[model samples]
Target: MVLAYLLSVIFTQPVVTMEAEAIQPVALRPVANLKAKDTPNDAGQSIDLSWELSPDSARVKRYEVYRAESAKGPFEKIVEFLVPTTAYTDADTLLRNKKDYYYRVDVVGELESRASSEIAGPVQAKPEWFNTNRIPVLVFAVVYGLLLILYIEFAKRDREMFVRRIAGLDAIDEAVGRSTEMGKPILFSFGIGYLTDVATLAALSILRRVARRAAEYETRILVPNYDPIVMTAAQETVKQAFSEAGRPDLYQEGDITFLTADQFGYAAGVNGIMLREKPGTVFLQGVFYAEALILAETAHSVGAIQIAGTNMATQLPFFIAACDYTLIGEELFAASAYLDRDPQLLGSLKSEDIAKLITVGLIVVVSVVGTIGAVLTSVSGESGILRSLTEFFNSGFERLVSFLTTS
Candidate 1:
């Protein structure tokens, strides 16, 4: 409006003839040292532009920047309003890495506006493969990986890394011993869950150990499975266990039988076996449903020493009440490692333990710092050094946690 009004007023005060509408233009000093280059540390579709302030910048109202594909006059004004700063970043541009961009700055003064004599050009936006933002996460992954490998090596060397004894796991030998002394069969049941489940797999491993012990004691072992796959796997496990115990002759494929997959029907079948055969030791380890208490209570009434473990939390109280010993939650998952003490298992266990310790330590540190930050923020107001320190700590702590648990 200012430029248009000035032009109309000057041009309208005409003399005559050809010189009637001609008005002389006023001079304005353009910005100096204008430059543009591809932005650093980014997946580039952008460029950074900077320049020395105009000599007439104090007199000038503002400056406008323009961009063009070519070095000539057909430039588009990118800055709709005049910008006060001497520096700007032109991020919205054609992202084809092969294309070059040209930029010029125009200084607007009270009298007239002038374009910079030079334009920065030929700067190409390029993509970067390496993203620097995720360096913390990458660093954490490498460090945590190295730590796990180191602990695994330590375990392989037979170093005693103590894992607290689980009472439920420790009673397996006693249960097998009772079954042997009573001259009754030891019954192991992996409820409806298939061999694909981790809990079921752990149960199978524990069953293998129990079967071996039963073989050594010259005692019979029975595994009534719901899933046909688990039945087959159970037979193999029992066979392998007997073979390992030097009692291949004692292995019986029929003992690890395939019962119905129906939950209550399977429970009814197991209950009947408990009543008829009255196995001295009943092992229930797997996924179960409404039939959990039905089986556990029936076995309880039969005077069997039951050792039960399941991934299902809802059935835990029933097992704890009815069974002699119950492996709860993670104890069920840890059964195989607890029984065998394999270096690989122990290594994984210890590495996970270390990771847990680190996580807990971070949590504690973060909690205390965050609490202090909150209190200081409320009491002393948010503008102090204490608040700043807390803010800094909290941010760093959050980043650390996010990095650790990233994937």
Candidate 2:
């Protein structure tokens, strides 16, 4: 009986061991056709790797990427993916330019069982002079540059370049004259903007024109600033304008004064000046925020003719509501060219308009094609002719949209 029991136990133990070995996880198959190449249209120090998925992809837990300086190498693990993947870009900072790189991809399975592909190597990363993806942008830039040169030559030859009249800018002389007639001060506020802002810079150009006009009219102009730097610039600009107007003695340094840097504080100060001095004209030009309406409303209350301009879209509505003349976004930027009529500036502005026309035309064409494609796709009942037309329009639309977005 004891011998029989011992025999049965030995037989059962061997069977249990065999069943356990059968149920153990197997090593996943390695990925195939691994390829590595220099990344296109990019600066050096990047390599693109691609490979075929493993036959045992169902069993794969993750993919691991290993990189080395040479084919026969101590490869360092660079990256890993928890899900199945076939491509990776090794853009690690440690990768040096013009250096050869070798790569291997491993398909890892449950219990860390892994199979590695044959190493792909001898690929070097090099920078391209120009990115093909940005060719559209390059073309646009070249065209704009050529247009600028052409228009500049025309302007230099005294050819008349047409510019639309901006009523706000045209009214500057009128505003200054009214102030002179009423015996009231002309107030200009650079609304809570630093000297670094483009809106503020544009405002400086407009201020120069206004200051020159005021000097000619012998009107007292008050410039209240939110920034000290802006105040200094305003002083210099006014001084220059006064000299140009042949009224250097009329330029008062005290008029272009810096108020508190705080947004609301500056608004309160300017509002107080408007109320007390009863300025005949108020120019609110530059960057503005919540204080825009406050200042504009106060100037309105004091019976001031307000001319407002800003690039801030959020504050434009308030300015338009309260001010007599509002210079919308691009109009404010075009002030320097309009006021100065510099040949170079006028040429640049003309080129900008041409570019805008081209952009708008492309947008319209793309929208028409995409809409037609979508409509045909929804209605066509597997007709060959309709399918062909749909493909043509959709592909064209997609390409154009992609180009526009990338450019």
Candidate 3:
């Protein structure tokens, strides 16, 4: 009986040992050499994280990275199922200033272990002066500066800058001369528009020049306005122009008169003046609406030499048909610089011309290259040289355009 019992015990012991070995858990080593870097975006809101996978977990499915507010943390997983070779970027939009954060990485497999990497300290990146989006703006500034310099150089030589004669300006002296010959007052109407509008300001500038001439010729100028602010500015401008011409006494307050704030009402008053005064010269230089035709036709009937200038696209055709001379959109603004010969304004105009030239050149190049590229793409031919040349030129032209626009 004792021998039989010993045999059974030995067999049972071997069986127990085999079962325990089969159930033994795999040991997971801590991930090694963790690193963090500031994100390149310069938003001060992100960091890049990287680490080495443990040898034991090499065959494991994925890794997990954890973050915590403190070193001894109830760590929370920030990223999971991450490939061992891949680095992760963490963008913490909720990050608070001067706050501490800790990070650790763990290797996870079929059988997970408690081992993890040493916690990394909180890191903060300083804000940058420029953002990525500002690159275009910087490029533009450089191009603009170069263009401005070129314009200044050209202006300094007193070179005869050729500007196409604006029909409206050409009619100015003629209108005043006609008024002088006819011995009739010249009716000047600065349409009801705000001072801040570019068209209104252009009109004002033209008014000063016309008023000076009217003063010199001893021709009466009657200005009807629709805006209070415009009325005030027009009065001041006409008065100054008259004073500049040494005809201060000839400046009449009633001449730079305010009609009404209402557009139609002001138009009626202007029409009435056109009929009643029957002035030999009529100057319309401001923003006008449907009322433009009415005023122009009325002035035409009175046999006045009409000169109109405006930037309103809708009203341009009517003025063109009815007025003896009319200033177009950009031409109206150019006239101010032409008459005044302001260095800054003239420089700006020159820059604009350079910009236009660059734009046209780019358009032509793009059209030609695009056609070539399309033809090459359609044919299954080796277009390596053509492709490379086109790409190079396109990139260069784009950069040049960006520079000009920003500068």
Candidate 4:
């Protein structure tokens, strides 16, 4: 009886030990110190993370990094299954100021081990320095500013400023004159886009110039628009232009009409207007889509001198093929300044050119240096002064660029 009781106790002891072992939590250890720092290129935000190779991680698999807006967090995992590494960088961009962020790291092996550390303090980052990525932009800005001053000075002195004739613009007078001779109204379509679109603004600028010329010629100008806002704005702009030309009485609201908002519907309506009015000139300006070809084709069929301008690269080719003259991307904007002879606008154009020159120079330098570096590395099997020179030039230029942009 005594032997039987002792054997039973031994079996029970094993079961109790096994149950305790199963319920016990595994320990997690941190391999690196947790660090927090402000993120670059933003208003204000901080990132907190750590690196660690867990002893049990080989069996367990990955790690989880948890974050809480407050120190007491109902902590939630920000990163899950992170591979073991010596460092991690937090790159969250949208964190606001004064908002505390707490973090904790956990080693998750075959199963989840206990968190390595307690929840970190609620910390927030203040807005740091402005980014320097816009150095090239600043340089261009300065160059343009100087050019504008010079142009304005020349304008004050009544000095003749020579500008190259833009084919698209030079045809405007002829287009309006043709309509007058034919006794047909001119049709102008501000392409399908919002009033605030850059292309729409460009179209409006040109329209003002066109309206002034049309008013002086006593020619009827018809504008069909798809966007209600644009339609309203176009009416105002045309009226203003006619008024400025001392022919406000000639301005008619009926001349500026609103077509359907549908893309194809607008195109069809404009095409019909072209067919019925037999307008001698059709000005298609602003943003356009597939309807561009359809409108251009219809205008061409009517024997009208079609002038089109748009920034959309894809639509440019269609315009080039169909229209008599097309204003490519930046030209659309530049044309307005050119027509108005606005010093500020001209200045901006000059600045844009300077930026382009700088960009091209940098590209050429980088390409040459990179090719030389590759060839030297392959042939010499060792780095020399040539290699050092190449690296210095590339790195120095990059750093200078970065500083300018960041500043």
Candidate 5:
């Protein structure tokens, strides 16, 4: 009996050891104080969530946020991973203000997570009417507006702000006089642009000056238009110009005619007009495409005094090669200010020119310093005054760029 009892005790001891080994430890610890609210100054499509960190957060590496449309929950994870800052703004609510949203935050670890003891919210989002990020742009716009207004006021006083005389605009009197002396019509077209184009508008401004001269000189002006809208604007422009020149009776309705909208077809009509009329002066200003060379070469063949102005860099070479006088780049844009000498336009033009000169000076200084610095760095690894000057210039340039772009 003693021997049997000892064997049974040994077997029973092994079974009890196996049962103790099978038991495992649980890893979850509940997170606390989860809350959700509407995000401020946002479109009605966002909710802000927050929670307190778990006291047993030793294993917590991230927080996960889950959201559901109802309290009973088929909760879906909204955020994949977030740092434990107890704050998360959910910005994907969409057009769902009428529905309540419930939220849960989980303390996440390597392989598991402990959810918040209670769900966060029945929250709704509201839209803000204004965006604060555009404040910098608005402030700068106001500053520039004030500067423009002051410049205009000063110009009106005839404060004698000298703007450089544009050679192309200056030659206008010579061209118009030649047409008047020859007893022939002057052909004027605003390139092949729609009326909405600013280049076309600028061309129209110069035409106002041209039409007034034609009216005063008792010279005939023929304007062939590619767009109907441009045709209407041109007629009105000429009529007003004639009225201003005290020759509204001389304003001919047939002078400004609408040609086909087809680009090459319009060029053909202008070419035919040039051949038939043999105009003494041809004014081509605005935007042009491939037809620029065609019109310019034809005008040259007609032995006409051609004055052309265009903002298109590609067409500028054609005009320069053919026309007697060509207004390059921004000169075309400033035709009004040059011709009218309107105090407001003149003041703005002078101010802009000054700004451009300043910009050029800064670019030149920065370029020289940078070049010198690079040479010194290549020879002696920036050990001298050249290097120091270069670094100072570079730093100032960087600051200026940052202020302009990022502010």
Candidate 6:
């Protein structure tokens, strides 16, 4: 009798516990405080939605977002978040501008159990005329414009603007004089460039300077061009330079002639002139490619004083190694301002320098701040002072980036 009574108690207790466990409810909770609004600082046809997380977020398998033109009846699911998320931006093409929208968020739990938040409504997407977040960019642009204008005015007022001398340009007279003393011709090649090229245009300014000096010294200047249009322009430039130097009679149109438009063909023609004439000074300016080294070396073989200037970087090292003087990159562009010292050009050049200074200063400041913030974050551990310093630096870094990049 005792054994039967014990067995009945054990089996009945096990059954009761199992039934209670099966009946216990799954704790599912809906998201709350759902909000929807037009996205800021953007073109029309977008809306932003946000919500508080469900209390049973750990059990949530995913969150689904729905949109409707009206709050009542059918709503279509526009997007879903497989992981927990608090916010979403609906930039779908179907979202029309100025049309009202309603949004709802649903928390899906394990085993298909679902709960939904109250609907959020009456939001319309619209475009903004100006993005307020880009105020920093506008401010910087305005400041640069004002600086440019002010400098131009100062230059026009006859205020002496100090400009550093470019050695390549300053040697123009020396190169022409050397050819004059040696009683040999000056060879100038506009290596395979069209009149439409900016580098070719910049080279024209340097050509004018060389031509003027050559005219003053009564030395013959030969300009071999690759493009016929460029040949015409070069002829006019040299004529003007000679007229400016009061030596128009010395201007020779035949000296500035077009060679072939073919790349290597033009280079060979220039090389032939360098070899036959064995010029005292060779001015290699404008666009050049594989022929840069060939021309520079040929001029060197003729024992010519080579003054090379081009906007091409690939050919610069070859010229620098083979030629006596070389103008690197933007120095070729700045030739007009440096040689002519025109007020407008000087003002523009100086303003660009100031702009560059501002950019470099900002970059340095940001780099230092970011480095310090990272170091502080790693060492803060348990120290409240260090942690506060880390937060301060991090906040400043974020603000700087946002100010520069956002909107």
Sum up the clashes in candidate 2: 0
Candidate 6: tens digits of C-alpha lDDT, residues 1-407: 99999999988998999888767646588999999999999998999998999999998999999999998948899989999999999999988999888889999876677898899998999999999887988888887888899888889998899888888889989999999999999999889878998889999999999999999999999998899999999999999999999999999898999889999998899999999998999999888999999999999999999999899999999999999999898888888999999998898778878877987887788888889999999889766889889999999988877765652
- Itemize residue pairs with steric clashes in candidate 3: 140-406, 140-407, 141-407, 144-407
Tell me how candidate 3 scores on lDDT. Answer: 0.79
- TM-score, every prediction: 0.61, 0.81, 0.60, 0.77, 0.63, 0.62
| lDDT of each residue in 1-407, candidate 1, tens digit only | 99999998788656443463244444678888889888776878888889888776666777888888888857888883354677888888554564788888888765455656488886787777887667866776776788779988998898997888999889999999999999999999999898788889989888998999999999999888899999988999999999999999999888889889888889989999999999999999998888888989998888899999998989898899889899997888877778888887878777777776877887787677667666665666557787687677667667655764563
Give candidate 4 regions above 4 Å deviation. Answer: 1-34, 45-62, 68-102, 114-123, 132-136, 154-160, 341-359, 362-380, 396-407
lDDT of 1 at 97: 64
Query: How much lDDT does each candidate structure score?
Result: 0.83, 0.92, 0.79, 0.78, 0.83, 0.91
**Any runs in candidate 2 off by more than 4 Å, and if so which?**
1-23, 30-34, 50-60, 83-87, 156-160, 181-184, 191-197, 224-231, 257-280, 289-291, 301-303, 341-348, 379-385
Q: Residue 210 of model 5: what lDDT?
A: 94
Give the clashing pairs for model 2.
none
Best by TM-score: 2
RMSD to the true structure for each prediction, in A, is 12.3, 4.2, 11.4, 5.5, 9.7, 7.9
User: How far in Å is the alpha carbon of 216 misplaced in model 3?
Assistant: 1.2
Worst lDDT run of 10 residues, candidate 6, spans 398-407
lDDT of 6: 0.91
- Give the lDDT ranking, best first: 2, 6, 5, 1, 3, 4
Superior by TM-score: candidate 1 or candidate 2: 2
lDDT score, candidate 5:
0.83
Q: What local lDDT score does residue 240 receive in model 3, on the 0 to 100 scale? A: 95
lDDT of model 3 at position 265: 90
lDDT of 5 at 355: 55
